[model samples]
Target: MIEWLATFLTSSPKPDLLRLVAVPVFAWAAYRDVRTRRVPNRTWLPLALLGIALLAWDIYRASTGAMIGGLAERERFYLRVALSLGMVGSLGYLFYWFGGFGGADAKALIVLAVLFPTFPAYMFPNTALPLTRTTVGVFSLTILSNTVLVGAVYPLFVTLRNALSGHRAPIMFIGKPIRAADAVREYGSLLQTPEGFSRGGLDLDALRMYLRWRGVTLAAVREDPERYRDPTSLPDDPAPPGDGSIPDGGDVVGPETTDATASGGDEAARAADSTVADPADHATDAEAAGADADGYDDPWGAEAFLDDIEGSAYGTTAEGLREGLNVLAAEDVVWISPGMPFIVPMFVALVVSLVYGDLFFELVTLLV
Candidate 1:
């Protein structure tokens, strides 16, 4: 069966093995990288090195076996090989620059490129050729086939694994991110989460951002407590009150007139707010106390912070942060975007494919 299959493929009997090896090898590496955010040197280095070695061997043989039959002859065949690899290389380069792929992925691409120049396209009945006068057909099909296969599987895998682990990222959006309680009883449909509320989890970016903001917030409130606090004053601790600074309730309050014990700014106003003689005069103190009940302005600017900065590459604005969060929340995607709208290797392929597909093609895309 293997011999028969070999005969059924390229008359050259080579790009087939190269393609066969390249596909699953690269596919597994690529998928693993997406899942673990790592592209091991072992897989990537071997693919790139072996590919180059094969291409080199093909080149040496082609030069001596110059009698191989073809219309354009040896020079053109070699040139065609270069073109095929070139197309793949160029796409990989762009993705790397745009952060869609890593250094290892870029190298893997280079390995794939050499096959065409080193071997021959007729190696697989693969009608792909590039930059040369040869039709732009094969590039398109490969890209389309690849996109459908890779794009669907990787993200689906990421989502399922993350969700199943009950990993809900920390949420600090609320006045105080409620530890997403296990039983959110609207009427009493005890739907509980396996994992209890977390500040947020599994997202390095948000955690980084949270830490930065928390430090800034603490410093700001510490430095400008009066400006941040609503009452403009805090209840004076009789003797070096607990912590020197009164607990400024969450919200901002106006200057208080009474609560002699209200906010500080007095010589004889050290009496308890309730003990004050003129309760009516204590209106400012009452208002300040009320405001404390509400949450205060985020001195740290946490309200506007967002972890997904890449999505902004196309255009993510401040106001759009809400839209971004809403999308994350709806999809239950935690901190990651549902559409990792990367610089898909297929962008170039799209144009190249359109050229050939219009000239000649038919495809059946099966989402499953």
Candidate 2:
């Protein structure tokens, strides 16, 4: 064991150290993304800077003839770095612009390009690192490919789970039926509405964001459903003692306010209503007054509350929220797609790339 450890440590100490440092950081980012569907932009800054510094150091070593390779090897190293950064960076941005990658995911790939422009070679007792390598040897590109391959397994798992549960509908593979009461507390998007299932679902994360922006808890809204349903209620701001007037800047519902929140709400409501017929009447007034809706009440003031908050943030639009609210208001059980955070797969790919190299490349090589 000691001999093996010594060999591993000696075989690319700098690259090994960087890989070790990255494991914990990527783990943290993945955990946060799973829990909150967000990772702060600042999360990547330190890693990005460190990657830049390391790349610069490598270049300096090559230029000073301290690196093992002579002039030809030095020029090759420079070319590799240029190709990796140029190709990987451009691809990352294009993915983001085309909506295939999240901002953080794209940044992760770019930073990876800076960090590991070429495969970091290592020798172990049983096998060699990077079992296969392409001519360009863009490590970031390899990571991206590996990530996609690793992520493909999740859909199969979802499909199998749904099938075992007797939900054979094609849509069931992507999402599951969850109680409407649990919707606010969950992650993912609503896949069902009052009318039926549709692919263009409402994002629950946006609903959570709107709730936070209003400074009101979903629990509180559930407790006093009618209070929130009223257009005049300003829960985020309290009135002065013995005064009924709403405080300034409070989200008061009125014609003047229609320009911002209400207008968005109207548009959202129309969009939501477009696909579904008028909601069915199945609940008593008493049950309708509650948050659970029981398929009778319109989502207790969901549109009005959405209209009271700031214009959309966190990928939420008023129409989406309105559609989601309509479903939540009108359905007891709604199907939701619990999105898999791409960072989780990216982290797994990073580990696999470090130890086994690109699995996709290896498979292709084996076939050929």
Q: Estimate each model's TM-score.
A: 0.41, 0.74
Candidate 2, 1-368: lDDT as tens digits? 98677777776546436656777888899988776667788988888888888888888888899778678878888988998889987888899888778788888888788888877777667766766676657787788889999999988888888889887775877888777766665667778655678867777766555454443444334434444443333333421111112223433232222223323343333232232112232233544434343432433345544555434434555556656665665566778887798899999998899877888888887899
Model 1 agreement with the true structure over 232-314: per-residue lDDT tens digits: 23222211101111122421111222333123333223222222133233345535434444433322222333332222212
lDDT of each: 0.38, 0.66
- Among the numbered candidates, top lDDT falls to 2
Give per-candidate clash totals: 14, 0
Could you list the CA RMSD of all candidates, in the order they appear? 15.9, 10.6
Per-residue lDDT of 11 in model 2: 65
Give me candidate 2's TM-score against the actual structure. 0.74
Considering only N, C-alpha and C atoms within 3 Å, which residue pairs clash in candidate 2? none
Worst 10 residues of 2 by lDDT: 238-247
| lDDT over C-alpha atoms for residue 109 of model 1 | 56
Model 1 earns a TM-score of 0.41
